[model samples]
Target: MIKHIVMWNVKGDTPEDKADGALRLKTAFEGLMGKIPGLLRMEVGVDISRVDYACDVVLYSEFDSHESLAAYAQHAEHLRVREELGHLRIARHQVDYPVTSLPVCAAAEAA
Candidate 1:
């Protein structure tokens, strides 16, 4: 499996604005599930821990292979979301890796 992870840090005019913007971003990220194929699963959401994290949103997804994840990342809709929110985001981080094995905690559950 291929794992894709992304994080975003965004700021708005006000706290309420920040909240609204974050939700919109989440919606935009989740929209990919319907538009993209080869997706086994995907998730997008705000960081509830409220710790000293730079990103306000987190996206985690699994695909059958690296190519599919790359395609999904390059999809026009995905690019649109990136372009649309590029200005609102203060910072962004992305990581992709092959899943050789699930963590022990997750592996147990999978069984």
Candidate 2:
């Protein structure tokens, strides 16, 4: 499986505006669920820290493979979401990596 994570700093002049943008971003990305192939999971989160350095929103998603992730980048629905909300982002960061299995603590497994 492939893990795709993204974080964005939204563009807004005030705190309220930024919060609104973050909510819109969260809703937009969550809407992708069940709309694309090989998209096993999709999650969006809005930051609550309200700290100066925190990103406004974060996206966590899983794909079957690299090809699927690539396809998602070009999918019409994905593109449309980007076109609509792209301007609301002031900064974006992303990371993609392949994972076989998540590590579980021995104590947890014993329980």
Candidate 3:
């Protein structure tokens, strides 16, 4: 499986506007499920920290494989979402990684 994660710093004229834009993006990303093949799961989060360095929104998605994730990147629906987001986002960060079953707490559990 492949895990794709992305974070964005949204742009707006005011904090309220930025908050609204973040909600719009969160809803749009969540709506992409089922429409796109290989998209096993999708989760969107909006930051409530109100901190200067906090990103406005984050997307966590899962795909069956690297090929599946690649297909999703080029999918028409996803492209449309990207186009919509282009206007609202000031900066973006993304990472894709292969999913593994190794337990992150294995050492702690052993102790």
Candidate 4:
């Protein structure tokens, strides 16, 4: 399985723009789930913290494989989401990787 993660920093040229942009980006992800077939799962939300690297939003998604993920990114439906985000995001960071096998340490986690 492949996991895709994305972090975003929203630059509110104005305070109002930041709030509105976060909502719009969240909306795009919710809407794309129905439109993108290869998307096995999707989750997105605000940072809600004061950490130094606290991005405005974090997106987590799973796909059957890298190729499927790639296709999803190129799909017209996703392109629409990007178009919407273009007006909202100041900067974005993303990473994709395979699930590494690890012991079930229930307490160890990072966000």
Top TM-score model: 2
lDDT (Cα, 0-100) at 78 in candidate 3: 90
TM agreement with the true structure for every prediction = 0.85, 0.92, 0.90, 0.83
Q: Considering only N, C-alpha and C atoms within 3 Å, which residue pairs clash in candidate 1?
A: none
For model 4, residues 1-111, the per-residue Cα lDDT tens digits are 789999888868765777678878888887888677768899999776847667888899988788889999899988988886786777889999986565367436631
Clashes of each: 0, 0, 0, 0
lDDT of 2 by residue, 1-111 (tens): 999999999998999999999999999999999999999998899999989898989999999999999999999999999999999999999999998765577557877
Local distance difference test, candidate 2: 0.94
Per-residue lDDT tens digits for candidate 3, residues 30-101, read: 889899888999999999998998899999999998999999989999999989878999999999999687
Q: lDDT of model 4 at residue 66?
A: 84
lDDT of 1 by residue, 1-111 (tens): 988888888788777777787898898888878778888888998876767655788888988998888898788988998899777788889898898987999999999
Candidate 4, 28: how far from true, in Å? Answer: 1.0
RMSD of each: 2.0, 1.8, 2.1, 4.0
lDDT of each: 0.84, 0.94, 0.91, 0.81
lDDT of 1 at 92: 83
Off by over 4 Å in 2: 104-111
RMSD of 3: 2.1
